[model samples]
Target: MFTFPILAVHKVIARGEADAAANGGFRNPWYGTRPRQGEKPGLWLVGDEGIYIISNGELAGGQKPLVFYSDECHPKGDTDWWDYKHRHFGGDDGIEFIDADLLVPSFDRNFGITHPGIRLTENDISFSLITR
Candidate 1:
């Protein structure tokens, strides 16, 4: 499995975008295509905690995306996971691509507690971790 320092998460996003741009524009790997017309933006959690924010599609394996209070710890219960998923993703399990635009607020509200380096903006998000 691929493991990245939490701070390096933004590189993952940049690399994904670079790959898509080089290929022929933006195609979400998870969906294998650009989002369908009218699809709302979504976000996905990277690093050790793999969560997602999907704007459209069907959920498989009961895997709902979530924005957590901290990535330092995993979700303690199903309620925390599902609640975030439902609130942000409208309970849609069918999301393919996590929207780039939504990364900042989502990370700040969820994972920022532990990873203060999680910074977001309209253009990009930056992340870093403090090693204890």
Candidate 2:
């Protein structure tokens, strides 16, 4: 499941663009453009069903990350994971490359982003259970 996260109220040592170098056009699915570096989470799950942003501590604390369903959960053409400043839509609206069905709710909510349909993958998702 994917999610469009806003800046949470917390203090963290964030790095540059979630990536050290903007060298290649591609980006890591887990880290994205500005992934949390160095600090290892208690658990992490990354897959084609998008990244599930949750946490062990938050789960224990009775909190859960917002899970947005998506088509291509895996990173494509350089997805940025650390871009919390703006909303992150699952797919692009113009073409028929990536998908956006289950992501409709989030699209309607964030900037009227146009989403078409949802995607189903056979693999189980791995992710962090984050706090809302």
Candidate 3:
């Protein structure tokens, strides 16, 4: 197992609903950018620093957001913070918002980026992959 501390959580200022869904609703400043120094098929545990991602040992480069998470910037409205664990570093599974906090945050932050009209139950959500 390899561990990386995400000191920054960038905000995905979506142009619209479509854009947010494409990003798994959250941004990690360090996921695909830096070169992978660990083994492939590895488990990433995501918490305050335990967010786990299954790395494939590839560098897809980094992302630059308008604002980043710090003591200064925090979630607004009903928006709250949540962590995502990708089954595959960057895969299609990355789109779905799987965690418990998905519905409320997605609705508040992105205005129903996870699912619009449909009310999502816990079973409806699944693990997401980190998008590029």
Candidate 4:
């Protein structure tokens, strides 16, 4: 399991271009991207859709990373992770970024189960992926 930094978390109102107008003309980062396959490998942790490891070459066709999410969750929008920064991280305006990684134990995409060990505290968030 290789660890990658969680660049940003976008508040996904909806997927694809269907909700563009409501989302400021921006489609969810993973809108036109497909899951990682063959020699292509990219991964994203979606709040509503679990993890999506995209194909390597898919981004060249025009697709954004899944790091940008809706700005409605945290009080400061996309500037922070929930209220962790203000509530527990010393009450400063400092933003504490985290890292995310994807592990593909199997190539099966049929499992729709949500990871149950996702832990969110004032200072950290963690997740584990186990595809069946």
Q: Each prediction's TM-score against the native?
A: 0.32, 0.19, 0.17, 0.24
Q: Taking the tens digit of each residue's C-alpha lDDT, what string does model 3 give over 1-132?
A: 111222121112222122335443333324545443222222222223222222222232473223222221123321332322222222222222122233234444553232222222335523222211
Error of 4 at 24 (Å): 30
Model 2 per-residue lDDT tens digits across residues 1-132: 343332210101011112222222222223444564322322222233344322212222343433332323434433653341123333322111121122323434565333222222344322222233
Best by lDDT: 1
lDDT of 4: 0.31
- Per-residue lDDT tens digits of candidate 4, residues 6-29? 222112212222233333343223
Stretches of candidate 1 off by over 4 Å are: 1-6, 28-35, 38-96, 105-132
Give the TM-score comparing model 4 with the true structure, all chains together: 0.24
lDDT of each: 0.40, 0.28, 0.27, 0.31
Instruction: State residue 38's C-alpha deviation in candidate 2, in Å.
Output: 8.0
Model 1, 65-131: lDDT tens digits are: 2233334223454345555444433344432344555444545556533333343333555554444
